[model samples]
Target: MAEIQAKDSGGKGGKPKAKKHSTKIDMTPMVDLGFLLLTFFVMTTTLAKPQTMEINMPVKAKDQEEQSQLKASNALTILMGENNKVFWYAGLPDAPAAPGVQVTDYSANGIRKVLLARRSNKDLMVLIKPMEKGTYKNMVDILDEMNITGIGKYAIIDVDPRDEELVKKVQ
Candidate 1:
């Protein structure tokens, strides 16, 4: 039988040594690449402003009977139809009437004028009731008008019964 033999040095009893391996990773290149990516993202991305419209949302009610009564004097209701037409009704709920109503087109200037005139009291609240087909852009424009007119205290009303279900389907 052939037998394996180890190499000896110094004519004595020394065996050949195995080559040493390095386990440490060279991190300089990796760190440089990470910094480059971070800088690129920082330079390319635009930072958005922190300003947002402060709007009060209505509480969820199980039934119309349990719905809380909102004061007519404090609340101003703006209605948006499916055709993108806007109408506004102010005063008591039972006696609600659309005054100086403009339809068929969205007018920020008119809305601004009306809101500014109506905002006699800083404590008054404005409520927006957007229909199902109402575009979000219209809502945002209305909010922008409100903001420009210094009407900050407002609420968004989801009067549509199918709103929650539609949102669920979308998600």
Candidate 2:
């Protein structure tokens, strides 16, 4: 019968011991990977431009009394249809005829004129009441124009007073 003998330690009076198991993980590679992912997200993620004015949207109300009070002074009511057409009405609603009442192709020129004229008074306000199917791009464009024209005073309104549900949903 063959007999197996254990290897002796270099100096100690004991058998050779197994190597100690390593539990340490290299964090450098993982940290590099995390930084790379963070950089990629920072490069690719789109940051939306913030709104200039604080819009106070009216709550869903059945009565017209609440709706009537929403129309304040220096309000510029802009009507946008599903077809991308923009119509603007300037000044108080009680005014028989809005001097700038016209359905025109969406452009900054017309908006600029109205806004500049209104900007004469620091307390002037402009209200935009777009339709339900109005594109967000259109709204953003209008907002951009307003910001560019230095008309910081404005509010968003519901074009259709009957559709309180839609207004609430959009708001």
Candidate 3:
């Protein structure tokens, strides 16, 4: 509620005139109502839960050499390093004069497009080799890309000395 007060002041004709009082608004109820609505919304609304990508890792085997083999053409090797550097190539690193690594970024038009293009080949596999110089975030981002591309045949492998040498040459 709002009210006004008046003070008598002398006018030009010596007659007393009403002086307007400054406005004073009591916002106690308004503030209370605002908090009440806020509490109600907070209590009644459902918060979105954090989502996670499902990662399928290979189980440890006593005889690692017994694992099934993948064709060379079916493999794409990713080498991640600091400063947002990504070097990718086809076939194994030990292949005779293995394919030259192509430099790319993690953007939607970069690695994402590359992976999507390779999606056409169901038999194709992705091997992620994160170098010692690579950041943890780089690994996570590449993993996210794998899940986004719906790639079921991907593995996080250690950096081979030969692959490390290739990264140095490309970077």
Q: Could you list the CA RMSD of all candidates, in the order they appear?
A: 12.5, 11.8, 5.5
Model 3 spans with C-alpha error above 4 angstroms: 1-42
Whole-model lDDT, model 1: 0.65
Candidate 3 residue pairs in clash (backbone atoms < 3 Å) = none
Q: Across residues 1-171, which tens digit of lDDT does each residue of candidate 1 receive?
A: 233444433343476555444355567888899999999999999999898766666667777797566676776767666655666656433444523333433665556667877889766788777876778898888778777888877777665443323323433
Instruction: Summing lDDT over every window of 10 consecutive residues in candidate 2, give the lowest-scoring window.
Output: 162-171
Q: What is the TM-score of each candidate against the true structure?
A: 0.49, 0.47, 0.73
lDDT of each: 0.65, 0.64, 0.87
Best by lDDT: 3
- Name the candidate, 1 or 2, with the larger lDDT value: 1
Number of the top candidate by TM-score?
3
Q: Order of all candidates by lDDT, from best down to worst?
A: 3, 1, 2
Encode model 3's per-residue lDDT on 44-160: one tens digit a residue: 999999887777677799989998888888999999987888899988887877689899999999899889999999899999998887899998899989888888888888999
In candidate 1 the C-alpha lDDT for residue 33 amounts to 94
Better of 1 and 2 by TM-score: 1
